[model samples]
Target: MINDQLMLLERAFLNSRAFPEKRYYSHVLWAPRTGSVATFPGLSNACSSATNTASGSAAWAEVQRQLSILVAALEGAAATLRPVAEL
Candidate 1:
């Protein structure tokens, strides 16, 4: 179960970071958004609002929705399997 939780957290984090082109877990890492934004230098502030803004991004919205669905599905599957596992 601990291994499963760790794997789920790993997957959730990777999905949250928006890196899905990976074919192998041993070869890919998630890039930090903070580091990406750190190089902006606070000049002009005219970067693409989707990647820069908090409330108007389609990527952010999809991440939220996908995570919610993932949580729901995982909980449902675990609930269904719990009683059977106990027996």
Candidate 2:
């Protein structure tokens, strides 16, 4: 359920004109290195390598914590707005 909400939020962000000039599709494969596979380099290189680093879990945990807070805030806002929406 949380994953679904996250995906929906992601789609909303992607569909918005927040970064009107930026190409989100191409950005996924964009990297500084040459002759390297696009997404593979990001995962195998920085992603996997970070797991062994000292702050990897801490950083990820922090992000999860922040996301939960955001989700809760959104839920609260929706609840508050529901009464007004009914009119």
Candidate 3:
């Protein structure tokens, strides 16, 4: 439900050209040491949150986590859907 929306948004955000590219993917990994996108404070909190635990502070991380699940579902959906152009 809500997870689905988050994933789509995450995917788009990932592919977005204006996410303030930092260089390395590890930079993308949410953690206090590396910091986060200034414009995307939600992403920062999400990464700062304790591992495998939910927090009121890390709303974006929660969304990201949910998005990961949805991404898997998206992959499944993509597999099931036949390509009209190919047909």
Candidate 4:
């Protein structure tokens, strides 16, 4: 199940890259060669450090890793909850 979710996330990322102009999120934008930067309007100081230090591909890979961890955590938490009908 985790693998499936990760695959779907990867597909979405690819689609976003293919059509960047239509992207809804501006916090992170994909750029080649130079590292991708996070353009968080009000949160720039807090978020830019990490992305600015890494190369483009490295930054992207880290994002993917973090997303995978998040998905796994959400799935695991959901699995532990009882259905409302059971109450």
Best-matching candidate per lDDT:
3
Q: Which of the two candidates, 1 or 3, achieves a greater lDDT against the reference?
A: 3
CA displacement after TM-score superposition, residue 55 of candidate 3 (Å)? 12
Looking at candidate 2, the ten consecutive residues that score lowest on lDDT are 12-21
Q: Could you tally the backbone clashes for each prediction?
A: 0, 0, 0, 0
Per-prediction TM-score, please?
0.33, 0.33, 0.28, 0.34
Point out where model 4 deviates above 4 Å: 1-56, 84-87
1-87: candidate 1 lDDT, tens digit per residue: 655555554443333223243333211133323234442211111233245567757656654554454455456545544433322
**Deviation in Å, model 4, residue 47 alpha carbon:** 6.7
Q: Which residue segments of model 1 deviate by more than 4 Å?
A: 1-55, 84-87
TM-score, structure 4 vs. true: 0.34
Q: Write the per-residue lDDT of candidate 2 for residues 38-75, one digit (tens) a residue.
A: 53222223434345557757535543443444455456
lDDT of 3 by residue, 1-87 (tens): 445545543443332211223333322223223235553333444455544565554545565764464455446555444333432
Residues 1-87 of candidate 4: C-alpha lDDT, one tens digit per residue: 555555444343332332234465322223231223342121232234345665566545555544554455445445444243432
